[model samples]
Every structure is written in C-alpha cells, then in structure tokens.
Target: MSTATAASKTWIRTSASIRAYLQLMRPANIVTAWADILAGYSATGLVMSEQTWPPLLWLLLATTGLYAGGVVFNDVFDAELDAVERPERPIPSGQSSLKGAIGLGIALLGLGIGAAAQVSELSLGLAIVIAIAALLYDRFSKHHSLIGPINMGLCRGCNLLLGVSAVAEQTQMLWFLALIPLAYIGAITAISQGEVAGGQQRTGVIALLLLSMVTGALFGLSFLPSVQGWNLLPFTLLLIGLVFPPFLQAADTPNADMIRAAVKAGILALIVLDASLAAGFAGWPYGLVVLSLLPGSKGISRLFAMT
Candidate 1:
C-alpha cells in the first residue's frame, strides 16, 4: 500500500475508536446531569451571576465526570450480557476493548470526586457516596428489579446534592427537593427494566405516578414564600408537554419498542423536568438555559443510543 493509504487507514481506525469510547460514555444521557447542577443552584435560591460561574463550573465538571463514569462502568459490567443481547454495543462489538472501558470508568470516577473536592469538602463527600452507590448498582443491585431502580434513583438524587453541597448554607428545602428526582428516576428506571422485552402495565403505571409526585412537588414549590411571585405555570406546562405524552403512551402499550421509546422520552425530557425545578426555585431565565440542553442533546442522541 502507498504511504497515503496507510495513513488514511490509521486515521479511520483512530476515529472509530474515539466513537466507541463516546458510545460507552453515552453522552446524551450524560447531558441530563446538568439538571442536577442547575437544580442544586435553584434549591439554594442563588441567582445566576458572573461570580456563580466558578463554582457552577466545578459542579458541572464533577457531575459530568461522575455521570459519564457511571455509564461507562455500567457498560463494563454489562459487557457479557450485552454480548448476548446487544452484540452491537461498543465493548461486545470489538470497537472498544473491555480493559479500556474499565480503565476509563475508574479514571472518570476518581476525576469526578477529585474535581468536587476542589469545590468543597461536602461536595467531595457526596461525590464519593455517589460513586459507591453507582458501583454497587452496576455490580449487584441491577439484577434485582426493585433495588435497581432505587439505587439508580439515589445516584441521581446524590448528583443533585453533590451540586447543593457547593453552597455554604445547605437549606432543608434543598434536601427535601432531592426526593423529587429520587422518586422520578426510580420510577423511570423501574419501567426501563422491561424495555428490552416488555414490562408489566403495573410497572408503567407506577412510573407515571412517580412522575406525578415530581410535578406535583414542583407545583407546590410555587406556593413557597421565597418563590411566590414568579409564575411557575409555564414551566409546569412545558414539562408536561415534553414528558407526559410518551410515558402515557408507554403505559398503554408495554412492548419492547414502545417501552424503549418511553425510556428515551423520559431521558430526553429530563432536561425539561430539571428546567421546571430550576424555574420553580430560581427564575425563568435560568430555566431557559437548562432548557437549551434539550435540543443540544438531540445532537448527541443521533451519535449514539441514549438507552
């Protein structure tokens, strides 16, 4: 072969490898982590000013690392299962090596915790707990239908708190608000368990109920003395517009493709849900910033499956 041909071949191989790693990380799903950071800021009633950027950047780094690391670790642990049920996945498809995936996961986990530590001791501690919860879910909890959802939900809730911990005051409301994501994500994860084949209608109903709790909580938050003046109606309506339809459709038809679509809708609409929370506690402007991620994530989703 000519030198140019060899060089082109090498470039193609390198590009393919990079794509595999990105797939392992599931960047579209990872974008949802930004919800945690903004919600954390909202919980604190902190305005989005220039000074906020420094700490916000740290939280973003921490959340991105942890969320990406968790997805990578899950892929690593599920490699054998994927080989059987999902042979096209990066690890099983030979595009990404198992050893490489594991190494990247471990590195990202450490980088996440270390980055949070740069922000504050509380953030670091929360990051460590989040990492452990994620690891356990990947190793053990995933097989147990009930525990798996709870574990995943808690991880997301911790992601929110990881951002809250950056604040000095750490209000009780922030802690209380964390439960919304916990309930919502837990329910979503439960429903996702059946996406590959089919899920029970009961499970789908329960997931819808869980989502109700989160939305209801957001509605109630509008009544709070701190957030009384700003109208949260638009935010709530937008969330319902984005999230409610697919889940309702999934509840009626619990087939493999339908459930998977439901799962993907839930994951994608998470930005809208998070934006509602941000708007409820903070203001509409910050919520708009969170909302922007939804369309941006569509680009990521095209590159790889969010599920």
Candidate 2:
C-alpha cells in the first residue's frame, strides 16, 4: 500500500474512535445541562461585559467535562444491564472498553473539577459534589425507585449552579431556584425509564407536572426586580402558559412519547425565557433571545421527531 493510503486509513480509524468516545459522552443528552446553566446565569442577571470570555469558556469546559464523566461512569455502572437492555451500547457492544470508560470518567472528572477550581473555590466545591453525586447515582441510586431520579435531578441542578456560582457571589435564592431544574431532571429521568419499561404511570406523570410548574415559577422569579425588572412578568406568564398544555395532555395518556414531547416543549420555553433574561440583564435588545431560541427549537424538534 502507498504511504498516503496508510496515513488516510490511520486517520479514518482515529476519527471513528473519537466519534465513539463522543457518543459515549452523549452530547445530545447534555442539552439539559446547558439549559440549567443558562437558567442559573439568567437568574443572576449579571452578565460580565469586559471579562466575559474567560468565565464563559471555563463554564463550558467544566460542564462538558462533568457531563462526560457522568455519561462514562453511568455506562460503566450499567454495563451488565446494558448487556440485557441495550446490547448496542458502548461497553456492552465492545465499541468502547470498560477500562477505557472508567479511565475516561476519572480523567473527565479531574478536568471538570480543575476547570471549576480555576473559576472559584465554590465552583470547585460544587464540581466535586456533582462528581460524587454522579458516581453515587450510577452505582447505587439508579436502582432505587424514587431516589434514582431525585439524585439525577440534583446532579443536573448542581451542574447549572456551578456555572453561576463560578462567576458571581452565591445567593440563597439561587439554591431555591435550583430546585426547578431538579424537578425537570427528575421528570425526564422518569419519562426515559417509562419509555424503556413500555408504559407510563399516572404517579410519574403527576411528579413530572409538579416539577415543570416549579421550574416555570423559578424561571419567572429570576426576572423579578431583585434580579432584573418587573417587566419580565409578562414573559414569565407567557412561559408558564406555554408550558401547561403539554403537561395536561401527558397527564391523561402518560405515554413515554408524550412525556418526552412535553419535556421538549418545556425546554424550548426555557430557552426562550433564559435568552430573554440574559438579554434583559446584559442590556442587549432581543438579539440573544432570537439567537438562543432558534437553534434550541431546531434541536428539540429533531430530538422529539426521532422519538
């Protein structure tokens, strides 16, 4: 074989390997993490004008690392289950080795925590907490009936809070607001499981609705005078209004697809609300909101269409 051909083959193999790794990280699933961080930052209403790039970069890297850790470790813990439920998964299918997954998990955890440490001690602390929670959920909590989703939700909530707490002084209200996304995370977790189980329970649907409402309320509260302006009241009301119909529908039928659809719609509404909050706080007029929502809507639409 020619030297050039050999090099091309090598490159192709490398590229394919990297793609598998990325899949293991589950990039599509990290949208909720992004939304959580965006929501937390929006609540603060304090966008840095001069030194924004540094914090934003740190936040992105840390979040990506942490999320990667979660995915890798979850696969490691679920290897046996995946053999039965999802043999095509990375570990079960031999697309990625178990050792590779565990090593990657540790590396990503370190990178995430290190990146957050660069931002602040508080951020670093939160990163550690999140890492621990992810590990616990993957190893143990995931098997527990109610505790699994709750633990997963808290992990996501902390991931968002880590971003905000990294940039600004911590607030009590921020902790309270974190519960909103926690609820959404719980709902999503339940829905994903329901789909796998081939049915949905009314209790699960009710839990999801309560979580969605809390999430909307928290988003609205972030725009209050304490954070931004009372003018945001209209936007908050609109978000809550947009969020309710889907939940009501899902409440009756309680299917996996319906729950997923409701979550998608809720995410779209959040993207809009957060972008608006970011704009309101940053003194930009509508540009950020438009930019954020367009891609978000497209992504969510594609995700649900597949399901």
Candidate 3:
C-alpha cells in the first residue's frame, strides 16, 4: 500500500478505537453523574460566589474520573454476562480487550483519587469508597435480588456527596439529601433488570417509582425550611411534576420504552434539582437549568430518532 493509504488506515483504526472506549464509558449515562455533581455543587451555595471555579473544576475532574472508572470496572466484571445478554457491547463485540479495559479502569480510579486528594482528605476518602462500591456492586451485588439496585443507588449517591464535600463547608444534611437520587437509581436499575430478565413486573416497577418520589419529596422538604421563600417551591414543583409523568408511564409500560422515558425523566429531574439549588443561591435558576437542558435534550432527541 502507498504511504497515504497506510496513514489513512491507521487513522481509521485509531478513530474506531477511540469510539469503542467512549462507548464503553457510556457517555450518555454520564449525564446523570454530571447532574449529581452540579446539584451537589449548587447545594453548597458556593457556585454562586466569586471563589467557585477552583473547587468546581477539581470536583468535576474527580467526578469524571470516578465515573469513568466505574464504567470500566462494571464492564470488567460483566464481560461474561455481557457475552450472554449484550454480546454487542465493547468487550464481547471484540472492539476492546478485557485487559485494556481493566487497566484503564485502574488508571482512572487512581487519577480520580489523586484529584480528590487535591480537593480535601474527605473527598479523597469518598472517592476511594465510591470506586470500591462500584467494583463491589458489579462483582457481588449485581446478581442479588434487591441488593443490586441498592448498590447502584448508593454508588450514585456517593458521587453526589463527593461533589458536595469538595466545595461545601458542611455536608451532613446535603449528603443525606443526595441519597434521594440513590432511590431513583435503585428503582431504575431494578426495573431495567426486570425488563431484561423476563417480561416485566408492574408491582416492582411501581414500588420503585414510589420510592423515588418519596425520596425526592423528602429531600425537597428538608431544603424547604432552610430556603426562605417561594423561590424554591417552583423548582421543587417542577421537579416533582417532571418526575411524576415518567414514573407513572414507566410503571404502566415497564419495557424498553419505559426505560428510555425513565432516562429522560431522570435527566430532567437533574436539571430541575440543579436549577433549584442555583436559584436558591442566585435567583436565576431557570436560565442555568435551560442551558443545561439544551445539549441533553438534543442528544436525547437524536437517540429517540435513531431508536
């Protein structure tokens, strides 16, 4: 082959490899992590002030690394299962090697821990814990009945807390509130597993939805007394309203359609939650929320179109 052709072939291979890594990480799912980070940051009420960017950037990096590590580790543990259930995944599909995935996961975990250490000792500890939880969930909890969802929820809740601890002076109450998303994650994970395992179970899906709503409501109520006025109410209502339709729909349908709808609802709930926090601090939460939703909405729209 000519030199130019060889170079072109090399470039194609490199591009394909990059795409495989991205898919393995599941960038679409990372949206939930980003939202949690933002919500945590906003809840701190620091993002509104002048001294925001440093801790914000650090926490962002740490969270990204943590998420990347979790994604890779999950794939590492699920290689065999994916071969049976999702043979087209990066590992089973032959686009990426298990060894390479494991190496990348370990590197990302190290990077995340290092980044968290720069922020605070507490955050560094939380990062390590989150990484361990991810691994434990993938390896042990995933096959269990309800333990899987609980593990997934707790993992996400920790990610949110990591962001909060990175910038906030106190995070006890906020950390508790962060567990609200855990309920959401747990519900979604359980419902998803149900869909894959067999057909569907309305009772389980409904129970999960109720758990999510209750969690969200509890978080909202906890913040309400601290928030002075009606400013927070609108955002809370928006979030609750946004979450309700999808939760109901998912329970009613309980299939792939429900899964997609649930994803959209989760994305919207994150936007509302973040915007509420921003508003509680800055009084202009709607604009920031809209900005956050634009890119996500476009992506989801494209995904729906393709589907």
Using TM-score, give the best candidate's number.
1
Clash counts for the predictions, in order: 0, 0, 0
Question: Quick one: ranking by TM-score, best first?
Answer: 1, 3, 2
TM-score of 1: 0.96
**Across residues 66-127, which tens digit of lDDT does each residue of candidate 1 receive?**
98899899989999999998899999999999999999999999889888988888888889
Point out the higher-scoring one by TM-score: 2 or 3. Answer: 3
Q: Which scores higher on lDDT, 1 or 3?
A: 1
lDDT of 2 at 44: 50
lDDT of each: 0.83, 0.66, 0.69
- Measured against the true structure, the TM-scores of the candidates, in listed sequence, are 0.96, 0.79, 0.85
Better of 1 and 3 by TM-score: 1
Question: Model 3 over residues 108-205: C-alpha lDDT tens digits?
Answer: 88888888888888888888888898889878897776788789888888887887886546576666665666776676666556444432656446
Candidate 2 to truth, TM: 0.79
* lDDT of model number 1: 0.83
lDDT of 2 by residue, 120-197 (tens): 778888889999999999899977668887998889778768757855555445576557667766765655555544
Model 2 residue pairs with clashes:
none
Model 2 root mean square deviation, Cα atoms: 3.9
